[model samples]
Target: MKRSKKVFITLMLMICTLSTFLVGCKKNDSKATTKKDFNYYTAEKLKEAIEKKEDIIILDIQVKEEYDKHHIKGAMPTYAFPVKTDEEKKKIDDVLGKLEGKKPIIIVCPRGGGGAENTYKHLLEKNIEKDRLFILEKGQTGWPYEDLLEK
Candidate 1:
């Protein structure tokens, strides 16, 4: 009876741990807004902004190698893709000054994926108002304006 009780308790503990992990793994949407909730700066809109000389900023979070090969003409190199860790998130601070003012900040990720979203959220947490933050709709990969890219 003692052995059986021990086994049952062990099983219960294991199940509880697994359940906790599963719940933790579930995405916490409260910290980050849905994609639709973000201010999506489409490629066409960016192109028009560039042509019109509007005040805007682009932060490229691609890997250094990819960013070196090509990025938006005036985009700042963050080289902080998948900005997940506390350390990685600090990379955004390096360009915090440039993010000031009413200019819109366009986060340019490889494929308009987590990197961009992460960067956008970090900026918001840093107190930059939502109106000044944007995620490039399709990211640099979907940017169709070849001339606007810098090698």
Candidate 2:
């Protein structure tokens, strides 16, 4: 009976030690694996950012026609559709060239969702650092128009 009790105690100790080691390892692994992604800002915050004259590029991904009607005061238009050819890529590069690579990019779409999301993903795939990307929470739908400009 004493031998059986010793064996059981040894097993329990081993399990406890293994579990604690795994938990500690998991915490470190998570810290290392954590990744930065595109950030979301509310309309008010975007206004504040603009007012502060923060170094940012507001990339409007709405269709050209809609963008022409009205858009955030200093937004540059860039269609959200994927670039298919070298010419299309050059056009995108031209727009991107207007700002320095380190400038934060704020993406806005007509009503958010697909356009903004897809554009965000495309930019990521293009190797634009995630820390430099942001999205307007609700796009033009949430914008107050106080800082809007019409072309």
Candidate 3:
């Protein structure tokens, strides 16, 4: 009788543990939304969006030198100034301020090689909703438009 009781308890515990893990897995699978969790779009789609004047911001996160060489017209250069101190943050704010209330701000870099993924997380940490931010999947170089302004 004692051995039987122990087996039953162990089985119950195993079932409970499995149930908890399943529940957690389910929660993870369900996609959650926030400004940081935004999806990256290709440049082709982005151009389409631009033509339609969609509510989005096309941001270039590359070095100014690269930007000066060539970039999509009207795209904002976000990392123009290095953010070394809190004062510099204000500069960032100034740029971000212009983009305030804008949905789906698309972050772009040279071939999508910049620290855009981290920046996206930082923006989310700042309470920017996930839906408000996006990344250009292929980036400026990958943009399929001949309008690429080259240096």
Candidate 4:
């Protein structure tokens, strides 16, 4: 009886330890994937990049009206939604083809948030390199630059 009890307790401890190890590994894996996938640039940093004439493409995902009303100067207006259809994917591919693949791309949306991340994911699905894509930390709303372009 004593030996059986001891064996049971040992088995329980081993199971608990294995579960803890697996949970820790899962957490690390998620963190590593997120770190590997994409990067972010604040509005100020984006402005500086523009000023420096860095070889980057600013891809805006806002609606046409919003884009026409105000957008970062030199930003390409490509409207994108979080959920993409086949036609939308094709459109994105066409736009990407226009740009040099080696150049870094920054995605933006209204209010400096939301749709940009979704667009980033779509870009990844289109096989854009993780290093070459970035999300604007705070979409156009966060941009401090005064000279937003108008239609």
How high is the CA lDDT of each candidate model?
Answer: 0.88, 0.74, 0.70, 0.77
Better of 1 and 4 by lDDT: 1
Give lDDT tens digits, candidate 2, residues 11-107: 9999999999998998888434322345787788888888899988998877677877778998888764334446544545677557457988888
TM-score list, all predictions: 0.78, 0.64, 0.63, 0.69
Q: Where does candidate 2 have its weakest 10-residue lDDT segment?
A: 30-39
Cα misplacement distance, residue 94 of candidate 4 (Å): 2.8
Q: Considering lDDT, which of the candidate structures 1 and 2 is the better prediction for this target?
A: 1
Per-residue accuracy of model 3 over 1-151 as CA lDDT, tens digit each: 9999999999999999999999888778855434345577877788888778887777776777888877787788765333444654444565766677857888787766435665565567667777777778877778778754545
Candidate 4 has what TM-score?
A: 0.69
Clashing pairs in 1: none
TM-score of 1: 0.78
Ten residues in a row with the worst lDDT in model 3? 80-89
For all predictions, the C-alpha RMSD in Å is: 4.8, 8.7, 7.6, 6.1
Candidate 1's C-alpha lDDT? 0.88
Candidate 2 at 73: error in angstroms? Answer: 0.4
- Which RMSD does model 2 reach against the true structure? 8.7
Greater lDDT among 2 and 3 belongs to: 2
Per-residue lDDT of model 4, residues 117-138, tens digit only: 6677778877888788888877
Q: Candidate 4: list runs displaced more than 4 Å.
A: 1-37, 148-151
